[model samples]
Target: MTAATGKKVLERRLPDERATARLGEDIAMALRTGDAIALVGDLGAGKTTLARGVIRAMADDVSLEVPSPTFTLVQSYETRVPLHHFDLYRLGSPSELDELGLDEMLASGAALIEWPERAGDRLPEDVVAVELTHDGEGRLARIAGSGQAYERIARSLAMRDFLTGAGRGEATRRYFTGDASARSYETVTMAGEETRVLMNSPRLVLGPPVRDGKPYAEIAHTAQSVTAFVAIGRALAGAGVSVPEIFADDLDRGFLLISHLGSEGFLDAEGRPVAERCAAAAQLLAAIHARQWPSRLEAAPGFFHDVPPFDRDAMLIEAELLVDWYVPYATARPAGEALRAGFRAAWNAAIDRLDRAEKSLVLRDFHSPNIIWRADRKGHDRLGVVDFQDALIGPSAYDVASLAMDARVSVPPEIEKTAVDAYVAARREHGGFDESSFAEAYAIMAAQRNSKILGIFVRLNERDGKPAYLKHLPRIRNYLERALAHPALAELRDFYRRNGLIGGTA
Candidate 1:
């Protein structure tokens, strides 16, 4: 980072084409919507080669054909994050850029503009400038940028440094997927080594205080750093659960080189949940909940990580998301204090019944997206779980609800029953498992979790500039209805119904 201009500048000698390709991977990981990359270099300076690398990485295809837009002037590709490759070498004039729809393209995605100097003042003020030049039979590259792109690129370069320190410096990097959280993923491949995953989850920042002078993450017991993943992951592995093996880690920087837990997920080809896989995942959860878990884990030698308790305050604050965000969005009016008070009172009463409930390490978001299915492996090993950084010591039934009422995909009633049965059967076989107590706890947890999701989706749409999550609101509502049917959630159901959030308006 430059002290005067705050521009992030990195100078490196690209010894070969592979070095330039690796640099492209680093830039691809740093990309965000509305970002622009100004490839500054003379002809034959490896401009198109670098752009091809970026496109291929984003496409998650190593051999993807990326032609230079020299003649056509601009070409685009459909990717997780859409990208446009522009070559202005044959441009008629600078105004042709507007005709080419650069502004409109950047609204939804990013652009890679080659020969960016031709555009003069038309280029975005916020841009990442990559200067490539001939350097003694090789190439010299200088990357300079600022803003969110700068921070992200700095982190991305640091991740490569982490990999280099771990002895995987020459590994190929490709964008995998990103979650609703701050984490993003990349697949790292090195010849003769098993494919590994690079999780770039930076230390979470506690945002402005929302209640009781605390942020929502605090009240929700969300993980603050990478230490939680290391702690919970090691603990789960020790208990015979099939979590990803941590090969290398930088807990302070929040970068982990973990074993690539296969690509197959709980969903079948048609994008629906497979019953057998759902049952298998439930059994895996049973194996997890059967054993006792420690409240504090030694994440590193002499560094203890105390698993936060998902207590009453946490539960209430989570449910309040519905009243605070979803209720107003659903009804098109802010919830009155009277309605809010009633909802809070009802939830407080509902949580009181959990005094006799079971407790375990709850993998809060144990749904389809997080479950990796390995058909070749047997028993519990057949399933691999990730995204457990926010694991909490909470009601064991919480995870059961998460699976059966999966928010990412629709789980039919039969599949839901299959999962619940698998869990109950495995727990029962282990002895001292109380079925009746679990039923109520499951229903209450399902309701609470769904309520929290409803608000979160709305917050994502309204506050976070991510409107895609709005599509899942209806599915979440239907799942919330299923949870509301339980006797344990009677009063909470009444509050919803009175607000026309569920069945029977009157």
Candidate 2:
């Protein structure tokens, strides 16, 4: 089913609910080994209809009565890989999914689940998420997933769509088809050499905000910019930072596709302790910041407004949002006006202090999530650095703050300090800055940066409604407590203790 290189399209309208079911069946029939299809949409939104179509198309012997399973929980069918069709609508909690042994089934056969979002984190990381929307009598289906299995299914769907000319010559192009129904949108590929492609979505929420219905810049947010980032990645290669190479970037659609840097981020890996990891992280930061930039961002205005230190307002805005949106939500009455006031003072003081320090290039979001622990011949044991689309010319200590006081992962105090020292030593060895004051500035900035993170995490849960970030609040607060414990922050620490921050928001 693999094509060396060719474009294919397919299209068919689901005139009715039954037609949607038929479409699903066709998609299922095209599935190869290791396929998982997750159906998502509102109630009676044709998810079941599509699932039925897929089931019918895949196995001729299977029955057509694919009910919603609102009560039975999950109805298993015998097909290739023994397809398990789940209706989580009635399943009260995600843990109940484990009770049904869905994990084992996911490995052996295909799984079709309706209301998959209810399963949340339990769903397979690579499971296909198919969103079905009822448009008048027809249905619009959007499919997204990753892995070799989904890749095959995507290829098959695209082939079917191409054979049938489903959405050809339209304003948008069909990227793939399942059974008779095709899902298409504006897609741009970055590089043919690498499988990972940079893509852009002018309409995707993550896309930069639109003004007047047109994108911001003429070259604005295209595959080309992704390529530039990749070029930067290559430049940083062998220089201690282990960033993924950019294979392609499709700017028209705003996709900065690049190599997948493996799944063993600090969160997934059971490698070193927090301190050891932070130490390694600090070493990388040292190498990155110590290097000279060819041009200052202010000197080259239009090229990159995203790079750090140059765009102070945007960076400050991110921190301010954390304070404005996160603090009130994370803290209880214990964090009264005094405690809150102290926190603000610390942030402002640190920001002011660091704002005046000698500046260097900073990878703004240099935390655990951005790192990948991959194997290589380099003396270091793991790959590090990613999610650096917002790299900037700012305080060298900014990225260190991001690493030692990570929001997603905790670094031991001893380890954090050791990492700080290591960065200081490395910076001095590279020979450009004053060591004495840099140490003081590093501690102050670390505390301030982490305070901002605490606010950001709280805000992520309270404002964005993504509560998962709340789990890391304790670690962030830990960093804050330690940073405040410094003699320089004695007054801030006293204010916090009086207010209730010592033990965190209770």
Candidate 3:
């Protein structure tokens, strides 16, 4: 379908579940309250799945059940912005839709319609039509939107891949402005005097380094964004992680002079060996889990209660990417409904088990890249952590999965076992241990983590336009497969393999 102004219709092929979900996310972000999306596709053609991704991303706190909406006709969820998900298959006429206040919803936030053809010309002229068609093993979506907003978002998605090769295509500057620097227009500073005073603060965050004859910091920083970075870095340091010791942070102008952690993380200190790394990383996780978190740090777009039970939704969403992207592209066919149903059942059961298990502090992103190696005040090698603002209360095992089978780096087999054993031993030493139950919890959490990573890698590539993440897909699949090797996950392992995910195994 042509856009109203006859601008070229943007055509994108969603090669996997991840790409489809990303398309949905991009479309969701591009939508204003008054916008509308008409989706047309066949069964298992990724209509409801894409819709689910869009709704969830847009309204992070609301529970978005992307069931056909075929029976209910429309499902409404509370969003930071309002959204109406309409499935028109059950509706016989436009009148049936009008009765549901379709027009009014279209005027606010967004109205995403599946089986939109059933609604005919009743949709407004400004509606964006996203058509999904199955290709060889993947799917192609043709998108036609009302205006430049859609093009802008689509363009942004086209460019952002977590592991894109597009690094500093242009030169950049780094700065090392120290403490007591003035708020120059080119600098970033936090000017609120009411801010806490520090006695003899030692670290400094530097910037505007020269890269290929250009000032990298100057090229990258804007007044508003630099301010945000300093604010967050300070917050994390205050929250107790050994963030690069900031000698100074000026948010108002745009300069932060901070200390740098040494290049080697605990993960890379080969001389210390695997067993040592795991133990140190585990201890760091424990400390982070013990801290009191500020309420505002909870993830966005979804409500506290609505967040996937113990990050269950996150796992399921990632798995869906396998269905949406990897399976189709790798195998050249959509995953069967029975296969999806079985996996979903496994996921739901996992979530239920997690919810029923003991809850502890969760460092949601406990992995290699986020860690810095340091000798604690006690003078032993310790783990310094970053990227943990999304931490929450969860099963201790989740963090275990994150470190033991990290996606970014490989943990040796013996080392992984040692880490798990040490963590369990620590629990016992602490005197509140249930050995058998803890083992079960760890296995279950491990399975969930692997599945979630699989989904995320795909999402990063296909949806976020960051195909660089695909390199990690094999590792993630290997992790999942290994987790499945445990006798407890036999059924889940078979199910995932039969459905075309074997860590590039196929």
Candidate models: Cα lDDT each: 0.90, 0.59, 0.60
Pick the winner on TM-score between candidates 1 and 3: 1
The CA-based lDDT of model 1 is what? Answer: 0.90
Q: Rank the candidates by lDDT, best first.
A: 1, 3, 2
* TM-score, cand. 2: 0.57
Kindly give the stretch of ten consecutive residues in candidate 2 with the minimal lDDT sum. Answer: 172-181
Q: Write model 1 residue lDDT over 27-126, tens digit each, in one string.
A: 8888889999999999899998899889988887889989889999999999867899999998888999999999999999999999998897898887
lDDT string for model 2 (1-506, tens) is 22542322223456777656646744664464456678888877887667777776555534667777779877887775488888888788899999988878776677888888788799767777777777777777666665755655565454334423422211111122111012122222223332232222232323354444543222122222443454445556746566765443333333343455555656534634465556667777777777776432321223433342433343444445444655456454223465445556655554565555767766666777667766453544375565554455666776777777766666677767787887887777888767756765666666666666767677667655557778877777788777776676676567556655556543
Per-model TM-score versus the true fold:
0.95, 0.57, 0.49
Model 3, span 318-434: residue lDDT tens: 455566566665666777788778878866765565555656656566777667676554312355554443344567778888888887876767878887777776666666557
- For candidate 2, give the lDDT of residue 433: 69
Question: Residue 364 CA error for candidate 3 (Å)?
Answer: 1.6
What is the Å distance of residue 386 in model 1 from its true position?
Answer: 1.3
Q: Quick one: best TM-score, which candidate?
A: 1
TM-score of predicted model 3?
0.49
